[model samples]
Target: MTMQTRVNPEVRPGTPHQMGAHFDGEGTNFAVFSAHGTRVDLCLFTPDGETETARVPLPERSGDTWHGYVPGLAPGTLYGFRVDGPYTPDRGHRFNPNKLLLDPYTREMAGGFIRHRALYGYKVGNAGADMSYDGQDSAPYVPKSVISDPETFPLDATRLRRDWSETLIYEAHVKGATMRHPDVPKEARGTYDGMASDAMLDHLTRLGVTAVELLPVHALKSEDALLSRSLVNYWGYNTVGFFAPEPRYFGPEGVAGFRRMVDRFHAAGIEVLLDVVYNHSAEGDHLGPTLSFRGLDNASYYRLAAGEPRYYVNDTGTGNTLNVSHPQVLRLVMDSLRFWVQAMGVDGFRFDLATTVAREAHGFDRSGGFLDALRQDPVLAGVKLIAEPWDIGPGGYQLGQFPPEFAEWNDKYRDTVRRFWRRDRHAAQDLGSALLGTAELFDKRGRRAWSSVNYAASHDGYTLADCAAYTERHNHANGEGNRDGHHANYSENFGVEGRTDDPAILAARQQRVRNLLATVFVSQGVPMILCGDEGGNTQDGNNNAYCQDNPTTWIDWDRMDEGLIAFTAACSALRRAHPVLRQTTFLHGAERTADGLRDVEWLDFDHRPADWSDPALGRICLHLRGSGESATGNASTDEVFLAFNNTPEAAILTLPKQGKGLWQHEIDTARDAQASVSVEGTQVEVAPHSLCVFVCAGETP
Candidate 1:
């Protein structure tokens, strides 16, 4: 006879003393950590969403954790908790029993939300204040918390270590990326497996990028406004579950399909990084419906107003900011990151609006628990961490202010480079700062040059083509009466707006694209090129295309411009070949001679020393003499020199004398012609908005 123990409800305090749901093999152990709760009840629901099976009272208490376990309850069971705590508004406790809650550890959820007045725990028609209680059934409208099968989950591991300096990140949307791809099977399209297909992998390898940064793969829900407007949140910024992958992105096999994709990416020597949003959720403000964290532990998970606990602090400019200062909330974030890298076999993570994740009582701290835990964690320390280091919070514009362990998206580099090539006044100084890895911003402590992730056009704004062809954001299709998106685009339309038949405008746009590509590749930082920037994909000037999941967001592989593709390939190849372009260490102004010449030299219009105070100059040349350091820390660096002309008029650049060995023209963005050998010590004429890189052989000094 096998012995069976009859389990009862046990309540106790968890870490940080909020609440937690832990799963054992036979049954799930549920615990909640509300400090002021007078009573706690665990509500069990049926699998089909109709019946209320049981209302068991939590029995045991240990510190702040209130725990209970049903001996027969297994994985896939639906459960929630109702807490009865102080209704104090000024003291920050808003626990009510009428609302249905979601388990924090829930791994899977089904169906869409049914919006109703019953979703809120407070009375909707309270004459004086919202403090009045309302007796309503929120179970029919609220989403149920699903217990996950831990046994079926994949093992989380930190593998595939790619160096940050050598890393090339490719940002992609999981669903929209493969939704219309011709080669992907119909069933697999818009799924993780489709992105993991041979067709996608082949394209990534051929493009020479090392990492693929996915745009928000976590489980998310469409906003109520979007649902009513017949639009959708295609970008998945409104996170529903940080621990679970959006099930729709997985194929017929569900979770296993995502695992397979991670395995394939690892096998192909390509790393996968998720763009995670920890700032806000689909649950909005006081008027918003009760969701997972709101009903279960609203006061713990959200940063509510000082005098009114129900009113939330909107730091993300979305709706509400997560209360990251709370210990349980911090644990949730770290746990989610670990699960992805371990269970999914992913390589790294790019945190979207990461500033919100690091906010403490004082302000955004570099040593905040979330950032500190990631830096100290053995699993996460080895993986890459990229931060979009800003939000709508006070003093949230932290570009290079992140800890030394992470890389930040440098919007300064983006804007400055754009203004320089677009022929804006006094842009030379700004361009010089960006090209030199923005030493003013990032040359601190012992951080390397790669700390800055330089990109001209990313997924958020106008594409590379549109950057040179649209002055204002054209977003009429967004249905906001053309009153959405940014006005200060800093983009020049060359000659005309939208598509034009003028050959000169078309030619200038293509050349400017090359110019921007050349600047990114040659700049002393990690360059991230957009997916379709190489072939000039346009969104018809829609800068804010987050909701546009149609052909506007898809990578148009059919109508690719062959000439631009060749030019982009050439630029990437040049960047890969030269060590000076992607140096891990910052260069000093003091001249250091190696291999018979200074490692780097700044050349003026006459090929002399550049004048720092010069106000009228529009073009300058950068003379990089190789230090013979190993290229990308592998092979010996080849001696090379480059000339850049940003002025509208063509300029004659005097080449450094080359004697015993011939100088090979490696890449010349000024012309479509292939590279050729240069005549000895001859003056190389560079076209307007053009650059050239030449390689030469020389003995060590």
Candidate 2:
């Protein structure tokens, strides 16, 4: 193919108020931020994104922003930036005009990043290391930012503002969740259109999840290491473009596919939450590729070491941490967030490695610029904001330290639930704290119970089935010699390691999975179900399947566990049906004025007050009633009883007789179905290694 210049369009000084390629119907304005750049050239490419049509210099620079206007450029025009400045790495001015840079606010991307030697600003295997600058054109290897008009993909303004207490989150991956669905169209599978397909919507609706927290959907590039091993970044956490959706998930409708999916989710009464990666860019460390941020303004975009500007602050464990404390960088993040909500129609965001973004000069600040900005933003404050709350850096675990507007993923809940079910010593006390929404961690700031987003398993770890079927992580497929994932996974295999035909072991594993799911739903917090856990999805013990893009991470619909699915739906329905299960107020065993009953009563197997100090006690029960002081205006008058037995022997549990109605059995983890039979007496048998739920049948006191 011959490289030819199709048009030498007239370039004039444009306004730098907007930070990306914006189309005003007749023409397009291009603007980019590069604090230390001496010159910026807007490289426009052909329709196929193969040939470079023109390189128009941005005629003006206003306050670190370079901008230019093209009279004939339209919304579909493909463009990138080539910035020229000092190539010194030690002083943090690694500006190389040879490398094509992506606009930090690009709404849509054309083509994908191809790992090539030219992509690196420094010469490979150079004796001088990063000091040796490579004079190679990287335009062919990088993705081009597309000129976009937000009005082109119009979305509904109506949002399903579901209450936190009533929200049931289902965390899923865009491709992994829909790739293998039989009902999704063959061509649409693994795309946004497929996820919003009738079959997927029906499944989500049936599961009773109010919100779908999707894995990172931002445009990302596979790392060179993974590519060398014939693997890819399946999780999409290595973000290259913060504003654009992953082009791989776009169907024939292109960027509009994401908007259509969100619209469909809203129509089905489900909110869409994105797992965003604002903590870092895809560009790794000093030796990593010069993809976007590094080539544009290395010092302004990344938090370089104070004394060693060449080395990056690896707080995210992804080589480089984003300098969110900087005013311009902060603006970029805020703008990206608003664009997603205002243009893409997403309900909220789950910030990945949240602590890194909120870190300041000293350490992780509870009132950091990024956090305070989100809390004060008019568009973001009303929407749901969740935080992973931890990073690999020092003082990273700030689980409950986020502001009141944010909900946090409770890893303590996950570990405690797993350890308690596995019968680990001294876990019963922790289990008590977890079931009540870990009040010790989150209750300090007058935060509600729903602030703790509870989950037994998440995308980063083993699946619910794998938790019961594997004793240790088998992440050998990740090419790290089984050392890539977490070592202490709190998992067990019952008797066998992998697959087995033994009915007893299979039954036990199924019961354990049910117990974990039940615990999540029955707990007084927002429940987040790992997508395929309800249907017994396993990764063959590959806990960290972030690199395995094949069936190892994809949900296999063919092997769907029908009974488990029914049980999961029943658990979600039970939580939804009873307001007592989803309490907005933190129950601290306080007395309720409505019925003269305690909001929560911990009981022993013998129905007496629970011996909470006993380390050997593994069986316990909870009596839950709606709180009179509940933040939710309409307090529930219903009562619920939950019995958990992790011991080898069954426990005879006696129910409280504080209510006037008979107790009806609602859930039994030992069995696959809901036992809707009314209890004849106050005493019931709780099967070993199982959980049971009973509700007040007729009337309250």
Candidate 3:
């Protein structure tokens, strides 16, 4: 029996310090937690993911944890578990030794997922369904979690210190960002090492981006349903191990390679913010595979039906929701987060479907343990905390409900801005509110203007090119018959459906792209530009290209749209230059003697009060004068005037004539040539669907 030993429960506390896994670098003591298992067997496997070496039962059980000390076993040991118990699904006990389980605390996973019937716990044929047990060994197919050494990385080796406010996040994918790069070595392409190379860092530095918000780097598996439909989950929203980086991104190497990549990013001034998927796991539903969590303690880890423990409460729309309300489950998440922040040296996190993380018995509590823990954490609190603040659950549309410290992905700002520039009727008034950080939604709290993270395009939706080329989502590439992505895109093709040779159509599209980008950066929130938006990257109208690992989604670095590239560079420069555009506080209304004009005053063509209800007033000028002389306090000193025109035809506006300083052109996105026009006078012409910003002459603003 492989020199087996057993220690019963009801002895000691289930703490890390008390676990048998704590050894003094001589050997590893194995400890696996299982709240409801009668027998927990630690199954060892070969390094090649082929043969099973041994199966040893954990000797000690304390509180709810099962553990045992092994003399020879160390860091490179490939191991999994087979918790022996009843195969009763109705009571939420789906334990079968036939199915191999990954450790929840696994620091590294080795192989990619191979779809096979052996990976599932129950028998293939289905009269008894999951209730029926199978005796077939699944050791040949499933990945074995490795035992990690706490001192694997030196303490001072890989950590980065990046402040939250100084953060400029560049959201990208580990695969897609480097999959087709010509400069990256062929063997290293589409890997973590490729993304962390000096070339990648140089590109980021040139763009002046601070942090790289990587799409889910967690270990993941494609759902059986999506696999059946011939599709893949490229965005990796489905997570398997919270503590492990996807082995694929590690390339052919493994955990050692990933550690090297983190070290490289720190060497540069860049930080890594992982996009985490804690709401749900890759195991879809009760019908899904008996992976780590479901097989171990299904009833405790997941939210089960009121009467039927076998059936899960599908709050995540992925068929199973993790019960973070449970104390142990909550601790698991906290532990995983701390491991990444402290060990991996990740600067921050962008929570995918974060609303699900905050859900409890009452509602989506902002004060839930997950949110509260992260908020109170000394390390996590200093890093950027961004939330995609919605899920497919009830009350899931929590756009601005996150705590003041977090920056939320503002879909409303993106949608409203898209609709407004698309010339949709009745969208003009709301544009002002969105531009001002949606005070109607995020104002009342102690939240600063950065609370709303605005974007015209992101990974989930249409690219900037598609937003100007497709009226509806053409997601047929996802292989779900174009039914996967969102339908109401609020996009408008200028004059053609896809790419066109017509100069008029192309010109209009380019101008619209600039207009959209300008609006996002100039808006009163932290603006996020989609990875390839700078160069007019297109998905061929596939709004949800989540499955495409091919070049269809990879950035075309060589063939960048010159005009779009130049415009994006200019836009970024303008945002960094002007503090008036990205202020901490909301701009108050018109006041007296402030540059002999109101701090901000609305105007029409005739320089008169803009009619709030006037349908004809598609154009308006917002004259903004900043009160702060320096970065420290608020005092009206710097003067900035913005002329905005949404009309098809240009409108003339009377500029604010004061301050003896001539207006210096900062940015204008109307001309065919990507150039700025500096002219100061009582009257100025505003181009159609274009915005222009001017700074005072002889002033470095």
TM-score of each prediction: 0.91, 0.97, 0.93
Give the TM-score comparing model 3 with the true structure, all chains together: 0.93
C-alpha lDDT values of all predictions: 0.76, 0.89, 0.77
**Residue-wise C-alpha lDDT for candidate 1, range 375-446, written one tens digit per residue:** 999867678888999998888999989988888999999998888887777787787778878988898978
Clashing pairs in 3: 7-59, 627-635, 627-636, 628-635
Give the best candidate by lDDT.
Answer: 2
Clashing pairs in 2: none
lDDT of 3 by residue, 529-633 (tens): 888887888988998888887788898888768767777767777677767777776666646342444556666667776666865447766666664345454
Predicted model with the maximum TM-score? 2
* Candidates 1 and 2 compared by TM-score, better number: 2
How displaced is residue 242 in candidate 2, in Å? 1.1
lDDT, ranked from best to worst = 2, 3, 1
If candidate 3 were superposed on the true structure by all CA atoms, what would the RMSD be? Answer: 3.4
Model 1: lDDT equals 0.76
